[model samples]
Target: MLVEVKNLSYVYSEKTPFEKQALKDVSFVVDEGQSVGIVGATGSGKSTLVQHLNGLIRLKNGKITVLDIDLSAKKPDLKALRKGIGMLFQYPEYQLFADTVASDVMFGPLNFGFSKTEAEEAARRAVNMVGMDYDSVKDRSPLELSGGQKRRIAIAGVLAYRPKILILDEPTAGLDPAGKREMLSLIASLKGEEISTVITVSHNMDEIAEFSQRVLVMNNGKLLYDTTPSELFYRLDVEALGLSLPHTVRIVRLLKEKNIILPEVLTEKDLVAALLAYAGGRNA
Candidate 1:
């Protein structure tokens, strides 16, 4: 397993009025080079769970070990543990604070014991990999760039670390459709290139269907289901977690329900082709 969690639980502000349990007995294993999607409603503990992968949030009740480091303990080598787990938070672009894009992307490696030359080289490579123009855009202030560019630069920061496992929380959250599509493609390519484990947390079911091989549903700090996308999308309670079936699945199922003849359409592209055939057959 690439990552493991055993009976993990965490509460905020224990022994106080603001106390709340963020996770309860959440357990799952992610194999290396696999893409897993996490879905849940707001405050469902998705963010809290991924933070434990890098020892950011210490496991308060149970145990979480990533790359063989005990995150539940207080004295683990967190810096080393974090070095292997890269996280890109929601609206990561806001984290950029450097004078230039190149400097901003280089900050992470520089902080974690990389020489200036090596860190700069890594930053350049990451920026290019993320589809940024280093010669022109590298010197520009990140705040002055377009929305997609800023987002990419933020991702480049983590990519420079060259972590083995990548976790992104709502990577495409506030983007136009074109930008969202491009971002998702970039994310998928990362898995292909590095063979790294990826876990994406989001409420976008369409993205979940298109990207992940496994899906994990969370509700009220408990893992509701950990299964394949096809299995979970058909469940009636899927929307209870603030997620809905992919439009392709919904359309295909509705046609079958109405007794309209249709072939199996598993992917979005397949569904589009089926719909085209359905239209053509009717017209003919």
Candidate 2:
């Protein structure tokens, strides 16, 4: 297992009147090179759960082992653990602060003790990996770039150090459709590459179904379902858990209602192909 958790529980404002249990006995395991998508309604503890993966939130209760390191251990090397896990929170572009894009992206490598030359090279590679022109954006101020560009640069900053696990919270938030597609493509390309695991928390069911092989559904601070996207989305009770089916899946269901039998489809391209095949068979 690349990541494991058992009997995990957490509470916010433990002793205060506003105290609330944010997580309760959550447990799951992620294997290396697997892309997992976590989805939930607001306050479902999705964000709180991923935070524990890298030790950002102390393990007050339960056991979490990430990459064979016990996170529940006292005074574990959090700094060292974090070096192997990269987390990108919502609106990560706002975290950009360096004088230029290259400087911002190189900051992580430099802080990790890389020589300036090596750090610059890593930054160039990271930027290029995200489909950005390094020479064109290197000297430009991050603040001056468009929202989509800023997002890519912010992701590059995390990629510079080449973490083993990457966790993203709404990485495609606040972007146009085209920008969302570009970002999703970049994330998909990371699979089986330098990153060994990727976990994404997103509300976009289409993106989750399209990118992840497995899906986890959370509700009221508990994990309600963990299974393949096809299985989870096809369940009749999925909407009852506060998650809608993917657009393609919903369309397939509607077609079935009209007695037009079609196989499961999860993407626009697949839907088009299915429809074309159905038409051809009828014509034949």
Candidate 3:
């Protein structure tokens, strides 16, 4: 297992008037080369949980061992831990502050002790990985790029360090339809090369259903479900847990209600193909 959490729990502002329990005895494991999706309504402790993987949120009342760093330690090797994990939060473009795209992308590797030359090389590779030409964007000020471009550059910054595990929070938020597809494709492409593992948190059920092999559903700061997307979306009453089915799944269910049964599908393309096959079979 690449990560292990046992009996994890956290209370925000302990003993204070505003104290609230954010996580309640949650536990899960993530292995290498797996794509995991985390889904939940707002304030569901989804963000709080993944933060512990990289030491962004302190481990106050839980046991978490990530990449063998032992996050439960009073003072864990955070610096070492970070080098193996890359995290991109919601609206990551807001985090960009360097004078140039090159500088921004190189920041992580440099901060992690890579020499200037090595950092630039990593930056160039990362920029290319995100489908941007390094020579074209390297000299431009990151603050001046378009929103979609800026988001890609921000992702490049995280990829520059070549983390073993990549964590994304609402990566498609604020993106146009085309930009969303591009972003998702870029993440999918990095599965086994630049990143060994992926953990994505999103409210978009369609994206989660299509992209994730495994799914983790959070409800009111608790691990409500740990299962595969096929099982969660197809076999479970997701809405009862305050979640919606993927649009494709919803369409299929609606057709079934109309006496047009089709195989349970999770993508738009598959849904269309299933409908066509059904129509052809009926005509025959």
Candidate 4:
């Protein structure tokens, strides 16, 4: 296993009256370079799980390993571990404080011990990876850019670190349609890299269905189901757990009722063609 978790559990304020259990013996493993999507309600331990991944929260119990190191043990080198896993939280743009976009994007690399020139080069490379123009946006103040531009700069900061694994929680939480599109496009492009694994928590069922190789769904601090997005969305158990099927999934299922043989994938364009095939085949 590239990343392993064996019976992990965490409690907030243990031995105190405000104590709350965040994760209860949760266990799973992610292979290298996999696209995993995590879905959960507001307080269903999603945030806690990702936080623990990058050592933001010290693991209090059970075995957690990433990149061949045990996180449960007393860690003497947290920074080195963090450099292997990049995490970007929801609404990350609100944290940008640098005078220029280049400065903000290079912050992580500089902190990782890269020299000024190396950091700037990494920042420019990452900016291009996120589909942003380094020349046009580098000198501009992060605050002066559009919302989409700010979001890109924030994501580029994490990318500049060149982490082997990427984890994002609710990455598209606050954005207009175009901004959301840009962010999602950048996210989708991360797949198929030889050296990195991408994981994200997304509420847009359509997005998950389209790009994710596997999905881990949670509700009420407990893991409910983990499966392929197409399989999970079509199951009655998912709908019973207060999750709705994506619009395209619902329409595709309706077409199946009329004897349509749709593609196995769950995507809007695929479903549209499947429905058209079913309707047209009916006349023959």
Per residue, candidate 4 scores C-alpha lDDT tens digits across 1-284 of 66787888888889999988888888889998789998876677888988888888888888888887788777636787788888888888999999999999999999999999999999999998888889888999999988888888898999998988888877877789999888887887776652368888877777888778899887766666778887798764666666667788877677679776566658877877776776688777
Ordered list by TM-score, greatest first:
3, 2, 1, 4
Residue 167 displacement (Å), model 1: 0.6
Give the clashing residue pairs of candidate 4, or none. Answer: none
Query: Residue-wise lDDT of candidate 2 within 1-284, one digit each (tens)?
Result: 88999989999999999999999999999988889999999999999999999888999999999878899888877777787889999999999999999999999999988999999999999999999999999999999988888999999999999999999999999998888888988898877786868999999998887888888889999988888888887764778888888999999999999999898877778989999999999999
Ranking 3 against 4 by TM-score, winner: 3
Off-target runs (Cα >4 Å) in candidate 4 are 256-264
What is the lDDT of every predicted structure here? 0.86, 0.91, 0.92, 0.82
Tell me which of candidates 2 and 4 scores higher on lDDT.
Answer: 2
True-structure lDDT of candidate 4: 0.82
How many Å off is the CA of 87 in candidate 2? 0.8
RMSD of each: 1.8, 1.0, 1.0, 1.9
The TM-score values for the models, in the order shown, are: 0.94, 0.97, 0.98, 0.93
Q: Is candidate 1 or candidate 4 better by TM-score?
A: 1
User: Lowest lDDT 10-mer window, candidate 3?
Assistant: 187-196
Which of the numbered candidates is closest to the native, going by highest lDDT? 3
Candidate 1, position 26, lDDT? 91
Candidate 3 residue pairs that clash: none
Which structure is stronger by TM-score: 1 or 2? 2
**Backbone clash tally for model 2?**
0
